[model samples]
Target chain A: MFAQSLVGAAAAVAAHLETLLAEHQALPVVEAMGYATRGGKALRGYLVLESARLHGVPEGHAIWPACAIEAVHAYSLVHDDLPCMDDDDLRRGLPTVHRKWDEATAVLAGDALQALGFELVSDPRCHPSGEVRADLALSLARAAGARGMVMGQALDMAAEATDVPLDLAQITALQAGKTGALIRWSAEAGARLAEVDPAPLTAYADRLGLAFQIADDILDVEGDAAMMGKAVGKDAGRGKATFVSLLGLDTAKLRARQLVDEACDALSPYADRAENLRAAARFVISRSN
Target chain B: MFAQSLVGAAAAVAAHLETLLAEHQALPVVEAMGYATRGGKALRGYLVLESARLHGVPEGHAIWPACAIEAVHAYSLVHDDLPCMDDDDLRRGLPTVHRKWDEATAVLAGDALQALGFELVSDPRCHPSGEVRADLALSLARAAGARGMVMGQALDMAAEATDVPLDLAQITALQAGKTGALIRWSAEAGARLAEVDPAPLTAYADRLGLAFQIADDILDVEGDAAMMGKAVGKDAGRGKATFVSLLGLDTAKLRARQLVDEACDALSPYADRAENLRAAARFVISRSN
Candidate 1:
């Protein structure tokens, strides 16, 4: 049931993005934007939809933020794959944006995608209350900007340039910004939309985000390249310190499981309505990719 | 008087941006964001401030949108200076962001700056009305997104790759998106904040934008590189079709003056209160850089 719901959320978000991008079909950058946004697991979007459902927010109102997060995720991937950044040629089983088109197109497409994310959330159709829309845009900017995702990325790049490996605490801080911030935002979005206190969701997301990163580290060690659709074992190849590197593989897996349990427990306020989110936490550790 | 007010606006905007950025001072990308934003003419910010004054909006409220536009402008310049884009080495008499920092830092800084733009406008402090803040964010996104500035940039890149020179109308449409959209947004911001019709400001800005671009083309042909603070005659060197190229130097200058006159005339509704904006239109054609 969780798997089917996740698929449904992805399809809904993709369709919405398609409609948005279709208005600018003539531009190559727009086409590139469309290309970059396609085919993600849409985990972030699923988090948005499931969380909104728990709060009884209409899907129409929820989908905008769902698509918004996916756009942001797509943008980060496009830019992270650029020659000057990660320089990955393949992503999601296809050539990266820079590989398929050119660096300029990749850069501009990434930029436009980011802008589209803000546009989606702040749009009047996103909610009836202008305050809600404004709040969404503001929080999203904070999550994605220098103090959050970009700061995390900068730290990651800095770490790679040095010989000294990061300890567990440092690595955790970095990943919290890089991956954890957006995931937390996605999980907290429904409560924000409903104008309710987001403490429970925030607690839920913090654990979920840490678990997600740990799972990613484990996948890098054990996952198949064909199944992952991108390069695996890159962390070890770069001599980068990750959860798997600091802790033993067994310890990392044990830690991830603990995080998932904590994440699920935090959702108890919603009781059974959060089953999909609980499943999502389990799936994060179990998925091949 | 006009020059002094413009300088005053720049100082105020810079100080505001500094306060906002100082919170993340430890990050390299945040530092790069500061570097990219410094020393521009702040024409867009001035327009926001001046237009707000005309509409009886508070300077405090106006400054947020002003800083927002400047942030967006900085991000564009940082990305545009990348090796894959214009490959510019110098800007405003200083090394471009990509030249000063690594391409990765430049890219991340630009991304963060773009997020900061939305954050500024959407923050509750920017306006008492949530609808106004949402409107600002939505409009800024549209101006900066695929259908607007990015589309124009893609077109410009496409033009360079092909042997066919863009004709007058095509170049006009291209500039309308490239440089014109942001300018229009900046000029119309105060009216939006005031919740008034932006028709007159839009009219004034449209003519001012065209005149500004024509003047840039004129400067590229006739201006000194040192005075302009960047390379000059590059448009002709690259065989890029510009207003001066298609119309000849004399006609282009004449056309720019004519547009400036129309731009000033469009503000006649405000009478003497718009004298500074009128002078600004003249400055667009007269400035060295």
Candidate 2:
């Protein structure tokens, strides 16, 4: 049921965003960007729509911010896969942006998409107050830029030293930056779009983001590349620091469950529309990819 | 006198933006960003102030946005110099951000500074309205992101083969991505912050950015490495396309003058405040570094 709901909500988001990102001006780039963006787990969007649902946010209100989140998330992936960055050539069973276009095009596409993400959040139709839109813009900017993703990547770059053996706290910080930061912000941004109190669920997102990372670590060990369309055991092969390495597989699996419970607990206060979000957290831990 | 004003204005920008950037939650990262940011020549800031002066914008009105523009420009340089990108270890006569802090920290600082630049623009303290600031933020975001500097870097990377003699238009587009686009937007954004007609002066900036590239091409042939603080003649050595290579040094110099003159002509309607901007056009050709 939760899996089906995630698909339903994500489809809703894609359907809504398709018109906004329709081909024009630089249509090829936009079309390429759309191709790169679709086929994500839609976990972040699910959390957003779920939170909106729990809070009784009117349908269609949260779509813009949800699309904005996905854009940023996808753009980050494109740049992150560059030869200089994560260097991955495959994502979600498709050629990475750099592989699809030249490296320059991928880099440019990612950069444009990042700016496009900010532009979307500030769309006059979605965010009424330029001030508030700017605020949201600021949030996405910081979360995706150096203070967040770039820093996490830098840490990942130097992680092979083994001296940087990350403890639980350090691991969590990286996760917060690498994956959780965006996820948490997606929910918060969606809530803020409706002018709702995000403080009520910010912690929920924190817990959920870490949960996502832990689950990812588990999947790397257990999943198949053909099925997952992502390199299996990449974390281990890279000698990168991960919770499973730091905590052992049993501990990491248990920790993921603990985080899932905390994430659900945080959402309990906003149970109405948040039901989807709550179920999404449970699904995060169990998904194959 | 113009040179003196430019230097003094840059110093002033460095001082004012310090306070704004200091308010970040991560102070070390913030200070490192400051280090990466503080040393700019303030040419872009001068354009903003001078452009505003052309329109008779009040002197006090220029400080915040002027500082903001410089901050944004500095942040772009900091990120651009990373090992994954330009890989330069030096900037503005000082060690680059990645050198000062670890790479991760450097990336974070750059990201934070970029976010901060937009945040400053959004606040009424810098510009008047959310509507205007949103546009301001959008303009900066579009020009600086992957499609702009990052894309340009990727192009440079792709062009690193033994030979790829680009035609004049391709060279222009490459330079536009690398050096021209941001400069063009810088002047436009400065005008936008002043709440004036940026279109007229943008022509000047377009010419100026192109002129700046032509001048850079000329310098590569004639410049001393000690003075340039960057590799000199590396373009030719690498067989990269450049104005000097495409049009020859003498023609490149002539094109630069024509561009500068055209830039000046674009500002004919408002001659008084355009003095520094005009001086900047001259500076682009004349500066040793």
Candidate 3:
């Protein structure tokens, strides 16, 4: 049921956003943007749908903001692959944008995507009022900009240690910047689409984001490159510390279970409304990628 | 009187947006952000005020949106100065952000400014509805992003030859893209803030933006590099075409007067209400930088 809903949300966003990109941006840039978008696993998007379903958000009504969330996620991936940042040559079995085009074009394309995301998400008709949409857009951007994503990058760059041994809290905070922030944003945006109080959803997101990162660490250690469809063991190679690096593999798995359990407990108040999210948490640790 | 109103709008935006930036983004980034923003003539901010004043928009109601327009204009200048774009070394007499910080930092700073702009512009109490604020915010982003400002840069890059004369229509099209688009968006957003129609003001903006660009071209030809604080003779140096290059100095000044006359004529219906704008058009030709 959760998988079906996830697929539904992703499809709706892809279809609607194609029209948006074509209409609002230049044609060549739009085509390149579409290529960057098609490479994602739709994991973050699925979380949005599953969270909204758990909260009883109408899919049709949620489509607009959902598109925005997906666009932001896509843009992050695109920018993360740039030469000045990650310098990654390939991603998810495709040539990364920096490799496909020059670095400058990729930069402009990614920048446009980020702006486009906020623009789409802030469309007021999707929310209860223009004020609510404005607030949501502010929250989303705050998460993605200097206070959130940029801060995370700056931390990673400024880390004095060659292999920083981050404690659980530090790891969580870093991932919150690197990955968790966007994950939480997607879920929160979904709840906003339903016009629900975001306190419980935020708690759910806090645990969910860490579990996703822990699972990523585990997969990097255990999963084969072919199964991952991207680099495995690349994190360890870079001396980029991970949860598994901080904790032994056995302990890291234990920590993942603990985080997922806490996440499930957070959602228990909603009963079956959160079943798909519970399943998603289980999927996070168990999947190869 | 026009200068005072323009400065009022710019100062109001600078003061309020500083708080928003400090609270959301880090103090350091905001400080650096402040550094980049403090350097402009606040021309965009002035346009918002002049139009607002022309339409009899109350001073209190005018304060919020005018600030929003300035933030957007500041963001465009930051991004446009990126080495990948204009490769501008100085902006408003200070080293460009990309030069002061890393290229990546400049990129993120630009992103932060754009987010900051939307947040300020979309503040709920400032507008009647979330939809209205969203429309205004989106219009600003559309002007700043690929199909508008970015596209203009791309076109300018491809143009290459400064000596080749661009015909009247081509010159107008380029000016509309590079200089006029954002100016036009500013008028429309201010009109929205007043809950007034932007149609009548289109003629005013159409002429206002051209006169602005023509003045810029004239400055490029006759102005001193030390005072302008940017690379001079670039139009002739790189062979990028301009109105003065195509029409020669005499005809270019004549055309500028024609545009200014048409712009003021468009405001004839407003009379004393448009006095500030009439003063602004007169001031444009006399600006040294």
Kindly list the interface RMSD, in angstroms, of each predicted candidate in the order they appear. 1.5, 4.8, 3.0
Q: Write the per-residue lDDT of candidate 3 for residues A65-151, one digit (tens) a residue.
A: 677677777777776777656677778787887788666667667767776776776666565433424666767766776677766
DockQ preference between candidates 2 and 3, better one: 3
Number of the predicted model whose lDDT against the real structure is largest: 1
List, residue by residue over B53-168, the lDDT tens digit for candidate 2. Answer: 66555546666657766776776676667675567876666778778776646644655566566655555555543243466666666676545654455456556643657789
Answer with 1 or 2, whichever has the higher lDDT.
1
Error of 2 at A277 (Å): 1.4
lDDT of 3 by residue, B93-137 (tens): 778887887666666666666666666666664564434346666
Give the TM-score ranking, best first: 1, 3, 2
Worst lDDT 10-window in candidate 2 chain B:
B124-133
Ten-residue stretch with the least lDDT total in model 1 chain B = B124-133
Model 1 chain A: lowest-lDDT 10 consecutive positions: A124-133
Cα lDDT tens digits for candidate 1, B1-289? 9999999999999999999999884877888999988999999999999999999988988999999999999999999989999888999999988888899999999999999999999987777454435888999999998878887898898898899999999999899989999999999998988889999899999999999999999889888889988888889898899998999988898999999999999998999999999999999999623
Clashing pairs in 2: A53-A273, A54-A272, A54-A273, A54-A274, A111-B146, A146-B108
Report lDDT (CA) for all predictions: 0.91, 0.70, 0.71
Cα error, residue B261 of model 3, in Å, equals: 2.0
Clash count list over all predictions: 0, 6, 4
Indicate whether candidate 1 or candidate 3 has the larger DockQ. 1
